[model samples]
Target chain A: MKFKAFLTENGVILLEKRFLPALDKMGKICHLFLTREHAFFLHNLLSGDGVQSIAQFHKEALFDDYRISSQNEDRIAFAIDISLLNRAVRSSVSICSELGGGGSTANRLQIKLVKKLPPNSTLPTPFLTFETKGYKSAVIQDVPISKPLSRTQVLELQTALDMAQDLPQTLVQVPDLNQLQNFVDRMKHVGDLLNVSISKYGDLHVQTSTTLITLGAEFRKLLVIGEQAFAPPEDQTFSAQTRSERAILRGDAQSVQVNVKHFSKSLQCHLAKPDCAFYGIAPQGACLTVIFQFFIPGTRQTDKSISLHCRLPVLDPS
Target chain B: MSSSAVDAEAPDLVCQLDNVQGMVDALSSVRWKRNQDAVIELSEHGIVFIVEETGCLQAKVYLQRELFTQYEFRAHGRPRFGVSLGLFVDCLNSFSVPGHSSFIEIRYPGPDMKLLLKSVDSLDSCIYAEVRTRIPDSISWDYNFEPAGSTPLTFTVKSAALKEAVDDLEWPGSNIQIKLQPAPPAVTFRGEGHGDLQIDLMYYVNTDLLVAFHCDRQVSYRYKYKFLRATTSNIPNSVIKDNRGSKLSIGRGGMLKVQHLVSVARSSTPHPHIDSAGYQQSSRIAYIEFFVKPEEDEDAVND
Candidate 1:
């Protein structure tokens, strides 16, 4: 009926502030499923960041993360106003800091939740409590969650088109966030869509054209993530094999045409994350994927990797 | 004339903090959209940020002297002045550059003084910024709350508990009605908007939440959820870390007061729930208070 947990304060903060806000920008509501070992944020807003955006967390990527007093096979799902969660989290963080939380001193942040209240209905209760034994402080927050969606739909757009032959994209690492900012400024006047062309040699071109003028910036020497990274694990079909082969057979350029606004929004990841990896996913299919990894200075381990797939409406060029 | 003579005003007060991020983070918590400009009052204690919303809601945050490494105060009349909160928050947030050792110094000598902000970056480079000041008006409203015995309702609960309640009921309603009773359903909150929500908190039943309870008579009032939500938005659910949360007071007229201990390093308390301030285990003791006015002239009690 009930379970209590001691989760990492930093993980909770990251969920509330960063991940939730990112989802809110894409849509009004999101579905969060929490299990003993994992938390998943699933949303299908055609996120200007792309077609689908999913942020997941396994316990290891968490800060001193652990689960307690719970039965196996327990999962909770609820639809919530992502923006409201943003505010709720801010409230929790400030309260914790004021009382000397988020430190080694008060190591434990105890959170307990009950599935049913008044001992009857199947519906969950309205509140959850976050407490720390070291400080003997407990924060009981109303779990502002709502009824789950009728059906949890998986919105991953599985495409038959290949990233290597059909897209022939280039991968680039952003050295500075300002560069992305400048790209966005150029995009404002460029038209509704951006034409991103990447050559096999890593010459990445971001081009925008209006009725009168066309602006393009070519970045050279951008480090490309190894081919194996993009290869789908099971079949490993059209990954490093076809990508290098096509470049050698003919000097071909892979380009993906995506909404200028969506591409720019994805670039925003540069502000919160130190490094950004931009991948041109589907040129003809109209999708761009970006993955961000974060490091907190001297921290030994890191957690979840956020992958954003921004899909533009596909066009048939016969 | 030396450069100092050209700017003859020697700053009135100056303060240095080992980390400016903490101070900025403190201010960032109260960045509610409905809030107007704030007044920075300086004294022997430290700086207190006053944020008021439409005159109906007010949150005063007091960051004590112990928070800063270096502190100095010098004023003409009262040690307080007004500034644009947006600009103030921006100046504080500029320390986001990574790996940069942000050694921050803030100063202003006297009235009509340009607020000076100087900081050392990670590379030992110094950055200086100046912002024009707004004239300090006599505190537009009097905060002089009623003295001692006249008070009617008061109790303490974990800030987390109250904040969660406010947050849970925030949606689907423009106004939130709070009903605090002496009976079994000690606290009831109703939210009415696109959809309505009614949640009841039993005094002894919700054991982990209600830290202390004292209610003599049944009292109820309605407030704009937008305004009420702003008060709890910045509160950290657990301020003292011990089970003790924050204090809530309701006067006869429906002016709700929320007092929270923002910082506490001292641990001199047998009952964290009962006492507002106890033995100090927390080095920093910042207290933030919010006064919210209830909706008046209501015909219908239930939506």
Candidate 2:
């Protein structure tokens, strides 16, 4: 197996400084899947509990000279501590930036897989080494990673990732994350689980209840993605047949109950500076999916280079 | 009364406050421990929350009728109920968004005797909460603090300075000694543990720091540092922001009473009537009082 890549300046700033730090807060370890087309950070994919997060980045988005060759269809997957990787990247970026000064993009950051003996150990260990070349000197950071998965194990992971990508039938955009975070923080004190309901008519209702009290918040008039937003005007009069048909068109609201902690952890994605977020729930689904959409800076177009989303495991209603 | 007649009558108590943050601050001042039960009594004048710690420490938070934009009480008599202080405060805090001043409507006897709270100011979203309340038990201890003498030995200091001084004295100390003397007109707080630390607030030293000093004789008393710390530990930021002063007075038998006033007026938009009214009634304020019994061994004396 062989993997080597040079990170672009924008990639270093976003991936190392923003994306990885945000993902680090969500989980301890994540699988770094490398392929010719893209790189994916998969969290909690093999675990049965906790939130599952998938952050995808196209090869060109983060790397200029990317090359990877492996036995199993040129694909490689391994688990590594997110914080350790983040720290290595941060140190490399800071050292390079310091040596190159602010304006000069002369510093080059290269990452490659290497097997070397770690200090205080005789046996060789696999590490993802970050080599930052400056004008005068170079700094290398070694981040330990798990042994690569076998071809069968890689196939199993690919299957899990494919299954986890099942999108909900309807998706509705949520309000500002800061506002939602403030509201969810308060709900956390009320109950352990949160009931999230998304309607086709563009309404999101979040409710938390205990035997003593019930607290709920409703955000209405939200834009429904891929569907026309609708609200019956007060002055309009609808016939019985039309009203029933309209109701059918609106569809039923999908409801899911999820752990409050898992939901809150997903909201930390705001650090990635996504332009907008969409929330959806499948009909009688066991999970709630949140999609973070980023737009290209200084333009209205969506950034196709990166795609990030998470699935929060739902609790048994019974 | 028939069930229909009871249903026809308005809720036992319904009140609306333009800014719920004030109520949240006042209640949080007395919430020192988790899952602490607070007894709430509603009268025509307003609402009073009473929380007691064992039989030694008692705190009361008074929210007057004027504090609310609308206060309606149709019950035959004052109603009292007990609820978790932490839960109630947290629920109120949820209704308050950081930048937006949301009006909250509160109603009692909601369906199954739950306290209903709903935010009415947001057009995009509405937050509603129901908190369960239980029958209030008889108060364990109620001390009618009689003046120590003809003139009560009281001193008022800036809330911010007082909080700082009290917080600073939290070293290795079990008891704090408070001494007040009229000769130099000063109040001294001394905490002795690993070493001795004394903080003096003299009337003539910095009049701004010591807002008021009314002591006719020298009085000395000792109080548990923990109980004393509780009085200033949670003085809300609103109180300090207003530059209000906290009044500490010594009653008979060395009973200490500390009072703090928290302004509940809406900061976002001032009502027209607020300007017409005089300074005192212009803005509504919540009153918080804490009563602490001095240590038994230390005989408080008039020197």
Candidate 3:
């Protein structure tokens, strides 16, 4: 296996300052999946509990020059401590900034996978090394990572990823994150589980209740995503009632009960400064998905280079 | 529904307060410990919250009826309930959004006998909370504080300076001695532990720092430092921000009574009300009082 890449100036700022720090708040360890086309940071994908987060970045978005080779169809996957990775990247950025005096472009940051003898041990260990080269000084940081998964293990992970990618039937855009955060923080004091309901009619209701009291907040007239924006074509009839039809007949919204802590952790994504955010609940789904959308600077176009979302595990109604 | 039916179902007490932040500040001033229970009593004149620490300390927060934008009471008698002090403060704080002064409507005896609070400012979204309340238990200690001498031996000092002096005296000390004398008209606070530290507020030195002084005779008493500290520890920033003064008076048997007045009016504009004389005035204020018993071992010294 071989992997090496030179991070662009924008990559250093985004990775070291925005992405990694936000991911660090979600979980301790993150799975770094490297493919020929893109890189994926997966959290709690293999675990059965906790909030699962996936952050995807295209090769050109971060890497100036990228190369990777492995037996598993040129795909490499390994787990590493999120904080350790963040620290290494942060140190590299600081070193560059110090040498360049404000323009990190003067320093070159290269990350590569290598095998070397770790200090206080004779046996060699696999490590991800970050090398920062300036005019006359160089700094290297070694961060230990889990051994690469075998071909079969990689296949299993791919299957899991495919299952998690299943999108909800309807998506609705939520309000400003700062407002939502303030509301959620207050709900946290009321109960452990938050009931989130989203309607195709662009209505969002969040509530928390205990045996002693019930608290709720409602946001109406939100923007519904495409196709689901209006009622399904009247001509298309079905043998059985669809989820949306059931919702309409019942005069209720699709609701999911999730841990408040998990929901709050996902809200930390506001640090990434997404252009907009959407919330959706899959039909008979066990998780509530929150997608953060980023747009290209100075344009109305969505930036397809980066995609980030979080899936919060739902609690059993009983 | 008939008008009579609607009246029967209406809450016993309904009030609206636009300055939620001011109420939050007053309640938080008495919240020294987590999970503390405060007994709330509602009367036609105002609402009172009584929190006590067994036999050592007691605090009362009085919110006058004038503090609210509208106060309506139809109950036959005073209604009392008990609630968690910390939770009450936190719930009120949520209604106050930063940079936006939200109006909150408070009602007692919600459908389930709970306290109902609703934010009535924004049209897009409405936030409502119901807090659980229990039957209030009988108060444990009630001490009538009569003047210790012919004249009330009281002294008033800037809240900020008083808080600073009390905080600075917290150095391995278990008890703090308060001394007041008419000669030269000065008040002294001495804490003795590893060493001795004394802070004196004299009438003639800086009138601004020592706002008021009154003493007919010399009086000295020692109080538990912990209980004394609780009085000034949580004086809300709003009080200090307005440059208010806290008055400390000594009653019979060396009981120390600390009083602070918190204005429960919007910072930008005060709530205007018409008096019987047809004059407009702002009378929105909350009174907070703390009564601490002096140490039993230390006898009071009077000359």
Best by the lDDT measure:
2
Query: What's the distance in Å from true for residue B38, model 1?
Result: 1.1
Order of models, best DockQ first = 2, 3, 1
Best by DockQ: 2
lDDT digits (tens) for residues B1-303 of candidate 2: 011222554788888887788888999899877879999999999999999988889999999988887889888788999998988898888898887676888888776788888776755667888899999879887777989888988999999999999988888478899999999999999988878999999898899999899999998999899899889999999889889999999999889999999888776565453345433434688999999998888866653
Q: What fraction of correct interface contacts does each candidate retain?
A: 0.00, 0.62, 0.45
- Identify the runs in model 3 with alpha carbons over 4 angstroms from their true place: A98-106, A226-251, B1-8, B192-195, B267-284
User: Pick by TM-score: which candidate is best?
Assistant: 2
Interface DockQ of each model: 0.01, 0.41, 0.29
lDDT of 3 at B76: 81
| Clashes per candidate, residues 3 or more apart or on different chains | 33, 0, 0
Every candidate's lDDT:
0.57, 0.84, 0.82
C-alpha positional error of residue A308 in candidate 3 after TM-score superposition, expressed in Å: 0.6
The local lDDT score (0 to 100) that residue B191 gets in candidate 2 is 89
Model 1 per-residue lDDT tens digits across residues B34-85: 3358888878778889888767888787877676656777656546677767
Candidate ranking (lDDT, best to worst): 2, 3, 1
Return the DockQ of model 2: 0.41
Residue pairs with colliding backbones in model 2 are none
- The stretch of ten residues in a row with the least summed lDDT in candidate 3 chain B is B271-280
